[model samples]
Target: MYTMNRTATTEMEVTSIRLERDLKDRLKDLAGNQGYQALIRDVLWNYVQQKSGDYQPQLSPEEIRASVEATAQTEERCVLTGKLIRPQERMLLGLTKSGEMVPLSVESLAR
Candidate 1:
């Protein structure tokens, strides 16, 4: 949910943290050309934004590849509208263009 600001890197402060060798290797593999350090920063920023209530996950209609009807087994928040979905409630699972599954209210896509 967080967008990276590549130009802001020059203002970043150096900080050191320890990581398990296996975890480091996995991050490296996942990061690929972007490099593990930049990926770590993105992961951390997303976590912080989500926890701070500043991150609102949303997708335009074009970004949603498909939607499937589903029943929520647990409470969920609609990614598009931020509406709360109760457990066992009928909902839609929107498959994003990037292949992420996100919760949606039944009326979210209603015409």
Candidate 2:
């Protein structure tokens, strides 16, 4: 049996924070340099979220597992050998005979 943590459902969490006056000024300048007139919490949050798996889309373990399984089952077969591929879900491929994988954009293939 398994249960989901209620707090883990969101990408954003709130807590009281303190900033030194000079640091606050620097942050505000950084925000303004980006063309926003005021500091946005999301921007700071994004900095904190880098590579922490805290800013990913919401998908439960079962759903993710199911998606992976489905992708495996429907892998685009390599035209050369008829072997199943770990499909590049967003792009087409050109399998060179030298066993090198080349990515081809849909637009280029359509032309």
Candidate 3:
């Protein structure tokens, strides 16, 4: 998961990109106080991390606000345990505190 690094200072290079007016407006609305540019960066970073296989799935029950039963339409890795969930297997879509819906093994929620 991509987290905002508030204390870390890193050099940034400016780049220009064009977006549709409607999309820009939506991003602005979703970003709120964080700003759309930062949101875009976060989205991009998440994509890169996932594609690069650098994402470590580590989540606690406390970080999950709720969960919904689901069946995997495709293979997925549990965000809480890094367990492989095969296609058509029982799983869960956990609603995290950050508002992301992440895959979880069915047993991950067992208490």
Candidate 4:
């Protein structure tokens, strides 16, 4: 007979995780009856909470605009292919170094 852990009762999708044998054993021991999935979830949740608490405020609109203008004036590259893209060049087609046509955003080019 096979039974799933308690999280299966929720609408969340099921996923598999692969861990080293020793690490798995340690987590299972720490998890006790809760199962390794619950323990891993708790560990990930704590990490996210701790990390998200350190966020900084966004730049002001004027500062953002200035930065974008400065970046646009400077040499820019395609984000995906990292090839140099000139300011006057037709942005959409001329950018891809790999020759794959990808969407290029004006805001992205400014940065």
Candidate 1 lDDT for residue 48: 78
Candidate 1 lDDT score at position 110: 76
Worst 10 residues of 2 by lDDT: 61-70
Worst 10 residues of 3 by lDDT: 1-10
Better of 2 and 3 by TM-score: 3
lDDT of 1 at 26: 100
Model 4 — which ten-residue stretch has the worst lDDT? Answer: 58-67
Task: Indicate the TM-score of model 3.
Answer: 0.72
TM-score rank, highest first? Answer: 3, 1, 4, 2
TM-score of each: 0.70, 0.25, 0.72, 0.39
Give the runs in model 2 whose Cα sits over 4 Å from its true position.
1-15, 33-40, 54-111
Better of 1 and 2 by lDDT: 1
Runs off by more than 4 Å, candidate 1: 73-75, 84-89
Q: Give all candidates' CA lDDT scores.
A: 0.83, 0.39, 0.85, 0.47
Candidate 3's C-alpha runs over 4 A off are 4-10, 96-100
Candidate scoring better on lDDT of 2 and 3: 3
Residue-level lDDT tens digits of model 4 in 5-50: 4455467777888899999999999889978877887677645533
lDDT at 66, model 4: 19
Residue pairs clashing in model 1 are none
Model 1 C-alpha lDDT per residue in residues 81-104, reported as the tens digit of each score: 767788999999999989899889
lDDT of 2 by residue, 25-92 (tens): 78777766643222445455544543343433222222211111122323443232333345544544
Candidate 1 structure, TM-score to reference: 0.70
The most accurate candidate by lDDT is 3
